[model samples]
Target: MRNYFIFVIVVFVSLSSSAQHTIKNTINNVELITVKDSKFFKGDKPYYFIGANYWYGPLIGAKNGGDRARLLKELDLMKAQGIDNLRILVGAEGDGGDSRVHPALQYEQGKYNNELLDGLDFLMAEMRKRNMYAVLYLNNNWIWSGGMSQYLEWNGYGTVPNPFLPDYSWDDYLNYTKQFHSCIPCKEAFYKHVKFIMERTNAYTNIKYINDNAIMSWQVANEPRVLISPDHETAFADWLNKTVDLIESLDSVHLISTGAEGKASYLQDIAMYQRLHSNKNIDYLTMHMWPKNWGWYSINNEKTSTITSIQNANAYLDEHILVAQKMKKPIVMSEFGFPREKESLNPTSSITNRDNFYKAVIDRITQSKVEKGVLAGLNFWGFAGFAKTNSENGKWLHGDDFTADPPQEPQGLNSVFASDITTLKLIKDANLLLIE
Candidate 1:
């Protein structure tokens, strides 16, 4: 009888122990993205910063659609180069009237490019197979077609929904916005989109990644900013905040990010908006800034330009990062690049050397408290671009010339400085994932 009791007790103890042990693979998607170590999250997990920031019509199955074949070819090579995150673009309103909704969800008549959906599908699958994460950027400052774009004008400022789009007349667009906003399919659509993204990729699982989930998180927007203009500050901020809320309300599973446009006011606005909506709603803060134009391109100042533009950026990062660190938000650098144009402030400056600028700036950024804790990841400027005759040329991207000062290979200066491919290998050696 005593032996029988002992055996039962042993079995119970073994079961309890097994239950308490957590498999890192079975991590809570929410907790996995937390900035600090809490009861729920494993904060000590080493970070691997790898990614790219591309906007416009790169992923939406437009003319230069990102096909699965091309995406896989790129990702496979980059994996060797050390890539972990691919920041694909998603705008507030779909580019074309009937193309935005996933084909599966869109009415037959509304369906445009199923290829975009298929490409996204392929991407998610590849990442999961490699145990990687694809951070899908929800929106960027763009409007290729209709709806909320009728009122705004194009300006270099990050004010309004998009520079190319029309401004919002709170009196007029609000009703339309409310109605449009209300129409989001919420949870059902959210899950369907994500599930499709995951399943489509899962079609070709390898032995190393036979079973896995979708990409990492759903980024809120590309670079939402109010800028020096007081124009769309309130409305844009409000819209972004609501987007975060809606995403969270719909699915509490995947992590969500605030793709805050990098600027003094924009960062402040996003932080404020984030607080108002719910601090915990955001997994982290990701923004884009080119201090060279703003003026901090080089600490050395090799370039001769007004220091005011750069001073603000240098000061802002130095100051805010301290606070952001305390908040424990992971830092994800979605975009960082210096224009190669001679007009670029950082061009040929004491502070403007490519390697000098990127290396110097990034070193300081990574050393910050927030960087050490949660913000250890960043995805720079863009991934791929061709000199192909762009449709947006002369119209929208007239100034976005990839031509170098002497016109080297497009983003040559910055690209050579970062040497993303090599950087990834270096980062990986240290157990960090570097994708861009």
Candidate 2:
């Protein structure tokens, strides 16, 4: 018995030492995404490409309702099309309420749904295999993903006043969410979540997340905003700085981004956007544009408004790019989407207007690449490859297919489907230029 105990102890120590060596080896071998002189580089080459927002990746990667075959097929399609960089949601929080993502990664504070966690691991493993990189946003400012507001609700702040519901206004939701910045327990719980995700070792690859090159950056949140009032600025900045600091301290390898939506999220003040992003820990800048949401486009005046939308978008891009140039950090137009012609959600609807908008945006990135400008990359709203959707009413049912549009919105509002040949061609062409 004494001899057996000694042997077991020796084996355990040897295994531990082997694991440590493997982690060290992986770290040394991995070529992480790095920023130098306001541009992204993959090892030694300048890296830029047209990517997609595939936020439902983990959900589809899940073993339960997840369609791994679909996930694999979609990934293959994306890779073949030169759409390599993906902006993905790391996970959602709370119970899957109305308009919120289902199969929550964290159903309770500090308690996670292991299946979703496994799904994330599987997603990363598959992405690594394809030589793709992910920009994984940890939280969301909106209620659609049970984000900051969910944290507030979890800490007994009151039930989340979802704006989509008839009872609550957008102002009510924003006012409630802003409180999260100052809530001590809410912030602490969020910090715990950040640590939990960052410290994880991939089940499939046997690689620590800190050492995985598959991740391009760890985004603070999906469109994290100051919300409603100027008074919330200080608290928002404080929370943001601390969060980025925590992320930096945990993993000095991967890059950190704020996932901000430029002036839109900063009370329409570009200076405020610049000031908050001045943190040394923040390695890059990100901005999102929504022509329809921002009122730059109108369905009533389709043709004229499409032109107006393009002009406004160009100005927005230029404004943000100037900030990026001054800061000497790369900027990515991470999320932008245009609805089909006449605001139709049908897959077969004319995408002529959408195509034109995409071309204009892609052209800007290509032009920047030529001039070596700070506009490093862009990921259009989303890709919903091979997912069949009900086009009749465009309302997304509980078990309906995931698309570029979030659950709360019309199913195909801005989704780039596998069958969108014209749009895919535009994407492919732009990627070709970027690579050249």
Candidate 3:
């Protein structure tokens, strides 16, 4: 009888110990991305590759009107093409309006659309399954997404001066958006959003966000700019630092970035770029390039202008690369795009010039990888996957399929469709070189 009781107790103890062991293993299974000596690493291997801006991923992953089939197909196709890193938007804010993302994640201050939140969970879960990483930006500087401006609007700062609307000019929008830096209530409300997102557990996988390996970094905002005057620099820097500090306090495992557009976000002052990013909490540097937007390329003068665009882009990249070297941080050209032949919105339009431009950009990273330089990665403007666009007018209506371009931009203007075989091949080949 005594031996029998002892045996039963031993068995029970062994089972309890096994259960605890399994739980611990599950919690620590993923190796989060880390940085050391100015480079990114994943489980002891150097990490460098081509990624894409798939900002609308979460929206499409939703159960309501969210096309799971298309999302799965796109993920598989991108994975097959060796594009594993994705820069995604965590969610959008404010009521869905003209030229704004519909079914927004946050429709009001402190209120959320649970469906969109579920979509975000689903997207993160799927990315984890594919062994892909995401750089999730928390907000946007632009009004197209109802970002900072929306927060200001919610705080009784008057209606957002949307630059896309005829009633407002670009200056009108810039001046209004710039006030976000100094608005106390707006800043506080945004911090609440930050905390809420950071603390939420993923509904699909049941893993807390801080422990999820699918997230490579938490970006502050998309193209967060100083806007118009150097006078706004002080306020902008303070806001940026506080945001980074909040993120760091919440999650010590993942990386943090400002999502800055290099000097372009700093009143064209590289020194200001360096000074702001000098924050010790910021893990890496990011820059964006738009040849057409910056006047380095012209659709009417494609032949000569394309060459000039490449040269100017290289110079711009080099200038920022120096800053990264000085700061001893890895730099990523997180956004860059070229239009199709003749700046056409048609998916069937020639991508010869676009491909050429992409190749030049990819080559820089590959060469840097060979030299073990700090130009660690590049994610082109976007990957549209299998999205069908309005090839004729490119205008985005409410129910239209989401593309890489925002609602305010022409749908196919800078989107890389799945049919862009040559561009995919370039990305694939470049990724191969990166891994080698």
Give the top-scoring candidate (TM-score).
Answer: 3
Task: Name the regions of candidate 1 deviating beyond 4 angstroms.
Answer: 1-34, 38-44, 54-69, 91-112, 144-214, 225-238, 262-278, 292-302, 305-313, 341-352, 368-371, 385-436
Q: Tens-digit lDDT track for model 3 on 1-436?
A: 9999999999999999999899867755666788898999887888887999999999999999788888999999999988889999876888779779887889999999898899899998998888899999999999878899999999999998888888999999899999999999999999999999999999988889988888899999999999899999999999999999999999988999999999999999999999999989999999999999999889889989999999999999999999999999999999999999988999998999999999999999999999988898899989999999888888998878999999989999999999999999999999988888
Candidate 1 lDDT by residue in tens digits, 272-371? 5334334577776665666654555444544543244345545655554444566666556666665443423222322233333345445543454333
- Per-model TM against the reference: 0.60, 0.94, 0.97
Clashes of each: 32, 0, 0
User: In terms of TM-score, how similar is model 3 to the real structure?
Assistant: 0.97
Task: Please state the error at residue 412 of candidate 1 in Å.
Answer: 8.4
* TM-score quality measure for candidate 2: 0.94
Superior by TM-score: candidate 2 or candidate 3: 3
Query: Which predicted model would earn the best lDDT?
Result: 3
Where model 2 places Cα greater than 4 Å from the true spot, the runs are 1-30
Decreasing TM-score order of the candidates: 3, 2, 1
Candidate 3 overall lDDT versus native: 0.92
Candidate 1 root-mean-square deviation in Å:
9.1
